[model samples]
Target: MKTPLTSFAGLDLLTSAVIVLDAEGSILFANASAENLLDSSFKSLTHLKLTDLFLNGEELIEVFHQAVAHQFADKRQDLTLERAGREALHVHSIVTALDNPDTPVLIELRENVQQLKLDREERMLDQSKANKELIRNLAHEIKNPLGGIRGAAQLLELELPERHLRELREYTQVIIKEADRLQTLVDRLLAPHRLPHIVGDVNIHEVCERVRSLIVAEFPQGLTIKRDYDLSIPEFRGDKEQLIQTVLNIAHNAAQALHERIRQGDAVLTFKSRVVRQITLAKVRYRLALDLHIIDNGPGIPPEIRNRIFYPLVSGKEGGSGLGLTLAQTFVEQHLGVIECESRPEYTDFRILIPLP
Candidate 1:
C-alpha cells in the first residue's frame, strides 16, 4: 500500500517552494524547492517546526495562528527565512488553512528579490512617465513666459536713463539672473529625456574605474575607494556613457555623504560586481544579470526621505539638485535594469541589476 506522501508527489514537481504544516505547526511536508531553499532534505525538514526556518518566525507563527483561527488565507512579503550557516533567504509567503483538521496550514514561499525588483521597476517606470509629462508641461508653461520676462528685463536695462538708472539697473540684473537660473533648472530636468540612448558593448569595470578616478580626484585627501570586482562578468550591450554617469552619480553621492568620515580619514567606498544567475527584471527572466553594488561607510541616508530617494526633486543632501539618482535610475531602466538601496546608521548600499544578453 502506498503511503500518504505518494498522494502529494505532484507538489514535489513544482518550482515554487511549498510546505505543509500540522495544526501544531510541525512540518508535515515540503516540496523540492522548499528543500533547496531551507537547505534540508524532506526527511530532515519534516522533523522541524515551521517556525524553526524563519528569522522572523514568531511573526510568521502569528500569521499561521491567525490563518487557522480565521480560516482565511494570509500573505506576507519579503519575509526573511533562517538557515543554518547561510545568509537569510528573502521570500514572499502565503499561508492557507487546509480543510483537514489534521493538517491545518499550507505555506507557499517564493524568492522575492527579483519580484520586488520587478514591481519596483514597474512603479518607477510609471512615476517616471508621469514626471516626464509634468516636466514637459511645466517647462513649456515656464519657458514661454520666461523668455519674455528676461527680454523685458534686458530691454528695461537698455532703456534706463543713465543718471537715474544706475541702482535700478541692478534690479533688472537680478530679474534676468534669477530667470536664467530657473531656465537652467528646467533644462537639467529635461536633459535625460533629450539624450539619445547610444548602445554599445559595455565593460562594467571600466565604468567603475572611471567613476573611482573621478571621485578620488575630487576627494583625494581621506577617502579610499576599493574594488571588489568579479572579473568573470562579461561585457554586455548598453550605453557606456550612460552607465559611466550612473555609477558616477552614485559614487559622487556616497563621497558627499561621507563628509564627516572623510574629515576623520575613515571614509570607505566599495565597488563590487558579480554575475547573478536566473534573475528577473521588469517581469522578464534572464539567464544572467550583472549585479553591481556601490557601498559606503557613511552616516547613511536620512530616514525621512529614504523611501522617496528615487523620486525626482527629492534629496537627502542640503543644496542637492536631487536629479543625480533620478537620472541614474532612468538610464539603468532604459537598459532594462533596476536599482535598489538599503541603508542604516553606519552603512549604505546601492545595488544596480542589469539583465545580461
Candidate 2:
C-alpha cells in the first residue's frame, strides 16, 4: 500500500529532495525528505526565499528566476544549496515549470549524498570484479589460439615450391603478423590486471607531460598535443607507471584516429585537468574529484556504436583491436575512477574523473 498525497506529508522517494516553489520564489511546499535535506520545516520556511537559506542563495535564486522566465529547456544546472544543519551542498539541479504560468511551481531535486558515497564504493568493487573476469576469459579464449596459428603458418611456408614460394611466403607472413598482433592486444588487455599498483606520490602534471612528449615524438610533422593544466594540484599517491599507461592509451587512440587531419596540418589534441569537489558518477558520490579531459579535433565517434564504445574489442578504426580504452578504463577504475566519452562532429572529448586523496 502507498500513502495518499493528502495523508502523505513526506516525499515518496528517498533518493531525491523535492520542493515546490511558486513563481515568486517562495517556498510553498516541501515533502518530508526535502525538510530532512534542508533541515527546516514548512511551517518556519514558508514564504522565505530559498537563496536566503544558504551562502550562494542569491545566485541560486537568480538562476531559478531565469529558468522559470525562459521556461528552461535544459534540465541541468550547477547549484550550491544548503541543508538544515548548514551542510553545504554541491548539486546538479533539474527544474520543471508547472502548466499554470501565473502560479508556476518549480521542482528542485537534490541527491541524498550519504547514499551516493556508499554507492560509489560498491560500484568500484563491482568494476574490479568484472574486469578480472573479463581479462581471464579473454586471455584463455583469444590469446591461447595465437601460438597454433603462427606455428601452422611457419610450417606452410616450407612446403611450397620455390617458384611459387614468394606468394606462399606472403600469405604465411600475413597469418603470422595477424596472430602476433592479436597476441600483443591480449597482452595489453591483461597487463593492468596482472601488475600490482605501485602506489607512490605522483605529480599528475608529470604524467601528462610524459604522454605529451611521447605523442609529439611519434607524430612530429602535423599532430600537436596541447596542455591546459591547473598546476596548483598537489601530488597524490598512485602508481606512476599505471597512470602513464592509462593516459598513453587514450592519447594514442586519439592520435591514430586523427591521421587524416594530421596530414592536413590541422590535428590538435588537448589535455586539460581541473579539481572538482563533490562529484556523483555512476550513481555514486565522492567528496573530492580530479577531472581530466582529452579533447581531439577530428571526426567524432560514429552514432550507431557510441554507447558501446567502451566495451572490449569494440573499435572505430580499421585494424584496431579496440582494447586500448578498455585497458585504460580498467586501470582507472582500479584507482576508483571513471572514463566517459562524449563525441560530436569536429570534436571528441574523453573525460577521466578520479577521486582526490
Candidate 3:
C-alpha cells in the first residue's frame, strides 16, 4: 500500500527538518527544512536512506529499528550529518514510530545550536542599531569642532612672526594635517546619514561585474576573481551606486585579508549569485530574493573580533579605519536586506540577501 504521504504535507511548514520512512526504512518524504539543511532537493532526499546522511549512523539505524520495535515509542539523540563538499552539521535528531502500518518511522532533525544562533542574531541587530546611532551623534559633534580647529591652525600659520615662521610652520602643519584627517573620518561616519537614496533599476550581475573590474584593477597579480552568477535574476529597484559601494567595500576587505595568499599566487575570490525563494529579511517575508555570496580562499577572519566586525571602528587589520564593513552593512540595510558571514581557517564567505519581485 502507498505511504500516507498526504498526511505529511503540513510538515513542510515547520522550520525543523523532518523525514518519513516506511516500515522497512525506505524514505517516503522529506520536509523543506530538511532539504535546506542537506542542501538537496526533495526528490534527491527521497532517494536516499535516512541513515545515509549521518557520518556514523549505525546507532541511528538501531534507533530506527528500536523505534519500530515499539511502535509508539520515541527517542532523541544528537547526530553529526555530513554531505559532500560541505561542512559537517551537528543536529539533534528524534525518531518516532507511528501506529500506522504504511509509514511507521519519522525522523525530526533540528540544528543543535539553532536557538542560540537566533538569540545572538536578535541581540546583534539591537546592538548594531544602538552603535549606529551613537556613531552618528558622535560624528556630528566632532565635525564642527574639527572645522574650527583647522581654521584656527590656518590663521595662526599666516600670522606667525617672520623670525619664527620656519620653526612654527612645522607645528602648524601638523595640527592642520591631523585636523583634515579627522575631518575625513567624521565625514565617512556621517556619510550614510547624509546621502539620499537614489533608487532605480538595478541588475545584480552588472553590479558584480563593476566590482570585479575594480578589484581586478586594484590587485593586478596573484589574485583571481571568479564569477558564478544566475542570469535569471531580474532587475529590481535599488540605489545602484550604494549597492556598488557595498559590494566593493566587502571585496576590497577580502583582498586585503588575502595578502599572504596573494603573494603565494593562489588567492581565489568568488562572486556567486542565485535566486532564493521563500526567504525572510529583517522580519519581513518575501517569496523570492536575490542571494549573493562573496567567498575568499584566505586566512579567515580572526575569531576574537569577528562578532563585532560590523561595529564602527572595529577592525581586524592594523591601521584599518574599520568603516568599510560598517558602511557596507548600512547600504545593504537601506535596501531592506541583510548581510552575513561565515569563516574558517581556509575559507571565508560573505552573503547578502535582498528581496526581489
Candidate 4:
C-alpha cells in the first residue's frame, strides 16, 4: 500500500520549493512549496518541463545536465523563475544529482530576499519586546527620583537667606532645570505606550500629504517634497494619527540630516507608494500589501551607529534625542506592519510595508 507519494511525504513539509526531474529534464515530482511558488497544482507541474517554469531555464538546464553527468552539485544565485500570469521570483537555485536511477536530478529554489527579510523581521520583533521592557523599567526608575529631586531643589531655593541666595540659588536653579529636562525625556520614552490604538480606514496618500506640509513648513527654503503615488491602491485600516506621525518623524529626520543639502538648495525628499503582491510580514503571507518609501538625498546615516539606530538614545546628529525612528517603528509595528532602512552616500531610503485587507 506504500506508494511513491507516501515515500516522499516529508518533502511536502519543507518551506523551500523542491522539484525532481528525470534524465530528459521532465518534471517527475513537485513538492507542496514548488506548487505554491509556481502557482500550479502538483499534477499540472509534473506534466511540464523544468525549462517551462524558469525564465533562465536554459542556464538552469545546463547546470542540471552537468550535475547529472559529473555526479556533482551546483548552485546558482539570484536566478529568476517565472510563473504563469504572476510576477517572477528571485531565488537561489541548487541542482544536485540524485543517487537514484529513476529520478536523476533535484532542484531546490529558495527565495533570496524574502527569506532574509523574514528572518530580520523575526529578530526585530524579539528585540522590540526586550527594548520595550527595558525602556519601561528604566523610565520608571528615572521618573520616581526626578520629582523628589526637583521638590528638594525648590525647597532649598526658598530657604536660602538673602546674603547667600544669589550663590545658592544658582545651584538650585541648575538642579531644577536638569530635573525638568529628565522628566521631559522620560515622558517621551513612555509616549508611544501611553497612546490609545485608534483604528480606522486610512488613505496613505493623505498621511503623506500631511507629512509633506509639515516638513516643508519647517524647512521652508531649500528642501523639495515630491510625491509618486499609485492612485489605484485601496484604503487599508490602521491608526490615521499614528501613521501620520510615523511618516512625519521619518521625513523630519531626513530633513534635519540634509543640513548641507538644504543650504545648497538641492535637498530632495520623495514619497513613493506602490502595491506589493504575495508578500510575507511577521511570518504571515499576505496576498497584497502597501509599500511606501520615504527617500532622501542626504549624506546618509553614519556607518557606526546604523545598526543600532532603532534603539533608544542612539543618534548620529549632535544633541539628537534619537527617539523619532523608534517611535515610528513602534507605531508601524502596532498596525502589523514593518519599517526597513537602507542608506548610502547621497541616497537614503526608509520603506514601510503594511498588509492590505
Candidate 5:
C-alpha cells in the first residue's frame, strides 16, 4: 500500500526541497519547498516518480536504491535536475532510508549555492575586516610622519640658498618628492573610506555597460566584451558611481591580464548577470540577490598572490599599485555586497553578490 499524503505534513516547514518515496522510487509525498523548487503543485507531482524529474538521474536512482537496500543515508553533489521548457538546475541532494516500509526513502535537495554562498561570504567578511584595520592603522601612521617630512624637506630646500650648497638642494628635492609620493599613496588608500555613498536606485546593467564601454574604448583593438544580462533584475539602492568604479577596477585588471590574448585577437570578457535566491553575504542571509559575473579568457591570476589579491599593495602585475582590487572590495562592501573569484589557467570568474529588496 502507498504511504498516506498527510504523513509528511511536518516536512512542509523545511526550507530545503524534500520528497518521500517508496522502495521502488515512486514519490509518496513532496513538501512545500519541493513544490516551489519543482514548480509543480503537490497534486500534480503526486502522479510522477522521483527519478522522472531529473535528467541523467541514473546515479541518483542508484543512490536511492542503495539507501533503501542498506537503510543508510547517501549523499550526492552536482546532480542536474531537468525542468520541462525551463533551464535545468544543478543541485546537491541527500537520500536517507526511512523506518516505514511504505515510504522507504527520504530525499532532501539543496541548491548548489547553499554551501558555496556561506563559504565565500565568510571568507570575504574575514578578509575585509583584516584589510580595513590594516589600511586604517597604516594610513594614520604614514600620514602623521608624512606631513612633517614633506614640510621639513621644503624648508631645507629653501634654506640651502642656490649658492655653495646648490647641489645639496637636489637631495632635499628627492626627499620632498618621495614624501609627496607617499602622501598620494596614503590618500588613495583612504579614498574609498572617505567618500560617503550617494545612494540612489542603481541599475547594475547600466554600471556594467559603462564599464564595458570604457574598457572597449581603452583596448579598442583586440578585446571583445559580451553581455548576458537578465533584464528582469530590478534596480536597488546603491551609489551608482562607486558601483561603476568597482566594476571598472575588476574589468580593467582582467583586460590588463589578457594582454597576450588580446594581442592574439582572441580575448573575451563576458559580463553575465543573473538573480540568485537565498544567498548569504557577510553573515546575513538574503532571500534574493544579484549575481554579476565577470568572466574572462586570460592567463589567470598568479597562483602565489591569488589568495591575497584583495589585500592592499599586493599586485601581481608589473608596476601595479595593487590598490585597484582593494578599492573595488571596499566599494562593494559599502553597497552591502561581496565579491568572490575562482580562477584557472585561461579562465577566470569573478562573482559579485549584492542583496535585493
Candidate 6:
C-alpha cells in the first residue's frame, strides 16, 4: 500500500527542503519547503523542466549540463538560479552515479545566496572590531591588576616569619600564579592581531601535511589523520604559519574530543581537499576556492550550542578556554577565507574555504 517516496514522506516533511529530479532535470517530487518557496505544487513542477524555475532558463540549462559533466567525473559545481517571482537561490547540485546512467538523480541544496553573503561579511567585520576591542581592553584593564598582584606577592613574601612563611608564601603564590596564567591568556588572546603575517606562495597540501605530522606526534595512540587532496590545485598565496596554526587548532580540538574513542582504540581524523569554482564567501566572489575539510568520527558538537561555537569565549568543553576556534577564524579571515561547521551525533565536519589564485 505504501511506496518508497511515501515511506519518506514523514522525513520530507521534517526537512527544511527536499526535492527529487530526474536525469533530464525535471522534477519528480517536491517537498513542503520547495512548494512554499516555488509557490507551486509538485504537479506543476513535475510537468515542467527544472530550467523553467529560473528566469534565465536557457543559460541555467547549460549550467546544469556543466554540473552533470563535473559530477560524472566525481566533482561538484556551484549553481545559481533566479526564480521569476521570488529571490534567487544558490544551489550545489550533486549527481549520484548509478548502473542506469539515464536515470541518475541530482540532489540540490538550495539556500539564499545573497543573504548568506551579506551575513558573512557583516559577521566578519563585527568580529574583527570586537577582537580589536578585546585586545585593547585586555592589555590595559587586565594587565594592570595582574602586575600589581604579582608585585604584591613578592613584597608579602619578604614580611613573613619562617614558620608562617609557607602559608603566606602559598597565598602569594596563588595570586602570582593566577596573575601569570591570566598574562598567558592575554598574550594568546592578542596573538592574531599582534603577529606579523608571513605571506608567500605556499602549497595548501604542505600546510595540511605539516599539521598532520604535528598532531600525530602528540597523539600517536589511536587517533588517525588521513588526507584526500586534489593534486591539480595550484599554489595559493597566504601566510603559511597562520594557516598552520588555524588548522592545528581545529585538528587538536577534534583529537581532544576523540579521547574516549581513542582510548577505546578507533578514532579517525580526515583532511579532505578539493577545488571549487565561482564560490562566494564574506561578500566577495572568487573565481576559484580551495575547499578543505576536517572530519572526525567522534561525538559531534552539542546541538544546543553549535550556532554559537564560533563566538569568542563560547566553549562547549568543561575546561576549554574556547579561544582556539576564534583565533582560527581570525587567521583565516586575514587570508580572505571562511570556515563553516556542520555536525551530527556521529559526524562533525569543519570546512575551510580559501580563495585560490
TM-score of each: 0.72, 0.60, 0.71, 0.72, 0.69, 0.69
Q: Write the per-residue lDDT of candidate 3 for residues 1-357, one digit (tens) a residue.
A: 665688899999999999998777878899999899888899997888866676667877888888778844888987776666777777898999888777888889898885444455666678779878999889989998988999999999999999999999999999999999999999899899899999999999999999999999989999998999889999999999999999999999999999999999999999999998886577677999999999999889998988888999999899999999989988998898888899988899999999998
Predicted candidate 4 versus true structure: per-residue lDDT over 11-130, tens digit per residue: 999999999888888888888998888889989998889778766567788888887786575555567666566776878988888776577788999888866677689888887888
- The TM-score of candidate 2 is 0.60
Q: Give me candidate 4's TM-score against the actual structure.
A: 0.72
lDDT of 5 by residue, 137-156 (tens): 99999999988998998888
Question: lDDT tens string, model 6, 1-357?
Answer: 213456446635544455565568877777777777677886787787776777865654554565555545323445565776676666654443433344344444556556666765677667766766876786678877888888888888888899998767888888888889999988888788789988899788899999999999999898878889998889988999899999999999999889998998899999999998998777789999999999999899988889777777788889999888988988988998888888987699999999998
Question: Candidate 1 clashing pairs?
Answer: none
10 residues in a row with least lDDT, candidate 4: 1-10
lDDT of 1 by residue, 1-357 (tens): 323766667898888899988778888889999999888999999999977776557768888998778657566656766666787676888888777677778898988866556666787778877866877787778888999999999999999999979889899999999999999988987887899999899999999999998998999999989999999999999999999999999999999999999999999999999999998777788999999999999999999999888888889888998889988988898998989899998899999999987
Which stretches in model 6 have alpha-carbon errors above 4 Å? 1-114, 117-121
Error of 1 at 86 (Å): 29
Task: Give residue 214's error in model 1 in angstroms.
Answer: 0.8
Q: In model 4, where do residues sit more than 4 Å from their true spots?
A: 1-93, 96-111
Total clashing residue pairs per candidate? 0, 5, 0, 0, 0, 0
Q: Write the per-residue lDDT of candidate 2 for residues 1-357, one digit (tens) a residue.
A: 422234335444555766666677777667776677677786766657666667656766766677678657435665656555565676667776655554355556676455545454465556557756977797879977789989988998988899999877988999999999888777877777688889999888999999999999999989878889998877888888888988998898889889999999999999999998888765567887888999999888889878666667789999878777777877787777888778998799998888887
TM-score of 3: 0.71
Worst 10 residues of 6 by lDDT: 95-104
Q: Model 2 has how many clashing residue pairs?
A: 5
- Which sections of candidate 2 miss by over 4 Å? 1-132, 145-181, 281-284
